[model samples]
Target: MAASNSIAENIAGSPNHKMLHGTLQAAGLVERLGGDGEYTVFAPTDAAFVQIPPVTREGWMLPAQKQVLHAILNHHVVPGRIDSAELERLVDAGDGAAILKTLDGRDLWIRRSGASYILTSGSGNKAVITEADLAQKNGVVHIVDAVLIPAT
Candidate 1:
């Protein structure tokens, strides 16, 4: 249909982007990802944030928790643009699963669950790709159903 925007701009335009935008801004990563790159961001939707306890989410938003927020957010980002098709291929090649290194330096397990894709966080939390292949000027975005907290 229409040309896609940068990841930051795309997030800004979505209904579920508020919490993510806040976290990105608080982490000081918005400007970085806003620029051109072949990045892949597994963006969690607003509903995904709801899965986190309110107090936990509140704590993460505090200035004192900036580093934690940054790490958590970075865990959702993988370098290079990985679209759904490529991801599927990777999973297929890996026999239904593939390990992806995130910007935070932890591995995220991507697997095929029936007709959809599932992302297993380092902490063992699982999120589904509710929407995929959101093409952006910088890269791509996959709207996920949960926030991926890295294992401690």
Candidate 2:
């Protein structure tokens, strides 16, 4: 809500705050992602979490699956602060689609769907950016409708 807040802080106040925060903590990525940076995060809402099977979500939260959870969360983050405008420019530059390199070393495709942006993951699953450009101290947050899962 406030510009002084970090990405993590913003998430803590968001509607999906609980699930997002829990996932970050479980993956041990809270500090890294919460730290200073020009990063972009496609934050999924609690409704999005429903898309994931209960067993899968439960498994990912286990200590033994830390790496898996880390990778999954990292897949939602881009290295630079890519606001909606920048994302639009990149999409136009790439001729209607841009390939964004995520922090997890995966490529997420960005494209325009009408007036909004759509993220197509490595697995061909799509997530719409429902809310764009929530600014934070560390970077920006885009509320997405689906949780992005990278291709295996």
Candidate 3:
């Protein structure tokens, strides 16, 4: 909640983002992501992760699947401090949608859905930003309603 904290600190402190923190930790990205770097994250909530099959999700956390997990998480992050206003401006500039390059170099489409901001992933899965503009020391976080699939 405070701007003094880093993105990882913010996620770790949030009740809705515990699952994301765990995933980051599992992927060996906790230290890297938590370090001094700007990142705009489309963070999925616990409920969103719950939608994935338990076995499949559990397997992703395995040590052997660290690269896969890292890639998946990277798909949800952009290397900057893009907040809600900036995202909206980008959408407006693009006339309806904006293409955001994820940390993994995948394209993440953001479009306006009335008052909500919808994100479409490369796998065609869509997610809505349920909560936005969570500012931190390194960047901002936007809590999404679904886990936007990564490019295969």
lDDT of 2 by residue, 1-152 (tens): 67798888778776666798899988888888679778999999888988899999999999999988888899999998888889988999999999999997899999997898989998889999999998889898899999898998
**Residue 79 local lDDT, model 3:** 94
Candidate 1 lDDT over 1-152, as tens digits, reads: 01367888778777887899889988999887888677999999888998899999999999999999998999999999999999999999999999999997899999998999999999999999998988888888999999999987
In candidate 2 the C-alpha lDDT for residue 89 amounts to: 89
Task: Report RMSD (Å) for each prediction in the order shown.
Answer: 1.3, 1.0, 0.9
Model 3 agreement with the true structure over 98-147: per-residue lDDT tens digits: 99999989999999989999999999999999999988888898999898
Give candidate 3's whole-model lDDT: 0.90
> Which regions of candidate 1 deviate over 4 angstroms?
none
Scored against the true structure, residue 3 in model 2 reaches a CA lDDT of 76
Weakest ten-residue segment in model 2 by summed lDDT? 9-18
**Model 2: what TM-score?**
0.96
